[model samples]
Target chain A: MSGPAGGGRAGSVLALVGNISARSLRVWQRNRDVYFVTWKTNLVPPLLEPILYLLAFGAGIGALVSEVQYRGEMIGYTTFIAPGLLATQVMFQAFFETTYNTFVRMYYQRTFDSIMTTPLTLEDVMAGELLWGASKGVIGCAVMMVALSAFGLLRYPHALVIIPFSFLAGLLFAGLGLCFTGIVPQIDSFNFPTFLFVMPMFLFSGTFFPLDVLPRWAQVLAEALPLTHVANLMREAALGRLPADLLRDLLYLAVATIPLCVAGIHLMRRRLVK
Target chain B: MSPVIEARALTKRYGGLAAVDGVEFSIRAGECFGFLGPNGAGKTTTVRMIYCASPVTAGDLRVFGIEVGDRPREIKARIGVCQQEDTLDPDFSVRKNLTVFARYFGIPAARAEERSRELLEFMGLWERKDARIRELSGGMKRRLAIARALINDPDLLILDEPTTGLDPQSRHQVWDRVRGLRRQGKTILLTTHYMDEAQTLCDRLVIMDHGKILVEGPPVDLVRSRVGKEVVEVEGYPPGLVQHARQSGWTFESDTGRLFIYTDSGEAVFTVIAHQFPSERCTVRTAGLEDLFLKLTGRELRE
Candidate 1:
């Protein structure tokens, strides 16, 4: 963050990586202000989407497949899918918040362009968007929690720890979605992310069934997805105890978050600053 | 003291199309300077560079004696920009818009609230302070945009065609607020194709065409130098009118139906010129900025 001095260019760009400034909070404040006015209308899909899936799949389909083999124990079908749907709720909420909503701010509203005229840099704006998106994802998880508790699927009191992990899941998906938005040329191209990437991740991330039920190569393919890591961690957390690979899961989540977030800012700055 | 903003060989290119090319000028403090041009003349592009909204492809631009190509955040802190289109926060009310904008400049909560109140009143938006953005009319939205730009009480204000879509009353109201800002000694830069607006508001202006500046001076001086003092319009061109003017050493610009002859004192020359045409053909009036504008930019329509 050096100023442009007499005979040299300003500080090199790499030196400014992860340079989240206090100004980013102002952007978050702006979005938060707007959210208060529109939150009711905004919460409908996130709250209802999972519950619909729960009643339709958990009650309707669970009667057919009453239980899933979990390690050495057999868990009720509703309990098996509850944590997975929680991950899906975070995915949908974080994805929509960053892609559709963030794109509207950047392109349609041109709010990002308006903010660019102010002292806040592009990095600040992107960081603020990421945080706001993650927050929206957490709200979605809350909606899922209410649904889970109401259905008696939250049998483990320690499943509450999954609430904290929900925030990390939100950040991960928000990072992926915003990074896609940084270089996408048009609004219609947004369908590619939803259909090609996000939709596939939602379907193949072991939300409906155990990955082990698939053949060896198909299971390997599912393991490579970002949602699979979050789903596995969330399922273990919802089972009332931290798994042995807790450290590894945390490390993977960090690896997923920091790089995508930095790259998203860099690409978005190219769209904005010029 | 040095000027508030200076541009030397400032260039901006979009691929092979040079939107702003080697433009040079300086804006003195406590004066209203304007960039006057028809559409696509690079007025907005040049001002966007000044406000750090656009990057400079080449050349030097300095704001408050700081290089504008870099140090964007520093320069941005001191200047306020009201863009051409309305970019108000649709979610916030009239008052909240200013309050939120003040926060961007890092104004504390107390100060931001105070300024929001004052600016809403100043822009005559206080009565509808709680109205959503969609509830406001076009004029009210424009007024709110101006108030938002003033949130930080910036030293240098930039308005890009602020009165373009405004009605006569709304336009006058905005002009009054701008005049009030000028009285406070704020350095103002604006772009307008309206000749009367430029003459009424700008202390000095640069007339641009095709990304190049054609003339730079005070409005009155530009009118005097380029367009003389009087103009005579004839309804139709008589035979050999072009040759006749050339032989008489007088200059005239002609359109499809009318001919405009320029002169410092048109009564004497107009009488001689009018007699050559029909008696109902000629009319004489004072030359103005519009005449000079047309003279410089030509009569062709530019989209």
Candidate 2:
């Protein structure tokens, strides 16, 4: 209903569409059945945590900060932080799906091995995983939108574009996560990538604050992060305005997906195919 | 009859070491052929290559007369594989596991549902079709795996160590299903260390050690040709006794820490062994695949 699945399905185009088929959707449907059992637990971190962050920082701390300048208007601090949280929620959901969930299914649970014995190729499995991760990201984004609106922070209906945007962002992280999954020899090794790469991006990519507030050198560094583009795009959607550099932001996202998805399938094939 | 599976000098190597080395064999249509081996004897590796889980490092391998390397998916589409390890999905219930796997083979959803029902009922899992995989007993899990393998009603069924961890009751249950399947004329290829299971289910088998076939024939013929009709064991005997038996013209083998006397005349060998060795140390029994297995693969433990 939130159009997240469109983004999720679209996520597979860059990762070798020739190798994927309608057969891959069966993998998505398999995960859908599993989702019925675990949906409550799956929604908790992405849905609840954002509200808690909104209450603590938006209301509790927004009372101290007077005014944050927006496009020709002085917006409350809660309004500024709300869209950033949406982008972060999508990223985290997709990351979890493609990394820990995929690893458990592939290694410990052997679900992928079970499927591979049939007519489905390894490429179908990877495409299915990417679509599933994107779907989760879309759901998280939509759920966070409802939560933001409930807090009386969401400004306009046009902000719903963030759902599809979040879906693309979800695919981005999922592709990167799968690349990690393909090479990881042990589960504990995931800590290195998350701590060094993911956590730094979360903190420094303008998620909690605007990048301009930091030093010029820090702002320049932030420009390189995908999350910075996501945060800016979500902010534009929330304010019912489009950024002049929207084409550049979208191009950057589209270009990044090509390599990340290709690498994801290639790396996973290295580990999967004998 | 034409061959369902044919391997000519097939080989599988991991790094510099060969796991399945230049193995050659052929399975006839509508017959249960088995691969008998000990741990690390390359039984699993050979089956893996046949199932296309691992590539053949050298030589020719074909399933249903189709080259495995050139058309693996086409070959995989027609064969059902019950792998050595339990790879059933814990996320799914018994019925869902089979049904979802059917989808991977491109079975329509409605047909998948019907086939799952039939397979569950056939495997005696109809009553427990709704149970989660984690809740099933080990034997039940194996049965469900077998049922899943049959969902597509494959032309060739490959079972790898199907009853390794099973109890006697469970083993019989699986064997009964296998026998029923054989009666229906399914072409089956299996690998196992259980000599009795092989002797019971296999019409033909090959005993393998160190990646090579040591003996291949029908069970009864293999036993008669390799170890004669009967065997006598003289336990705790000194080498002098073995040498004495050798000098006296008794056909015997001096194996690791045991003296095995093989002969067509068990009565004669038993009488002599009972007299020379202590009564507790001598015994006689019919020769079978286990003796050939131990003789060919040795008694050393394999990791």
Please give the DockQ score of every candidate, comma-separated: 0.56, 0.37
Model 1 stretches astray by more than 4 angstroms = A1-19, A155-157
lDDT (C-alpha) at residue B254 in model 2: 66
Deviation of model 2 at A212, angstroms: 0.7
Query: What DockQ would you assign to candidate 1?
Result: 0.56
DockQ of 2: 0.37
Residue pairs clashing, model 1: none
Each prediction's TM-score against the native?
0.95, 0.94
| Model 2 pairs in collision | none
**Who wins the lDDT comparison?**
1
Interface RMSD of each: 3.1, 9.5
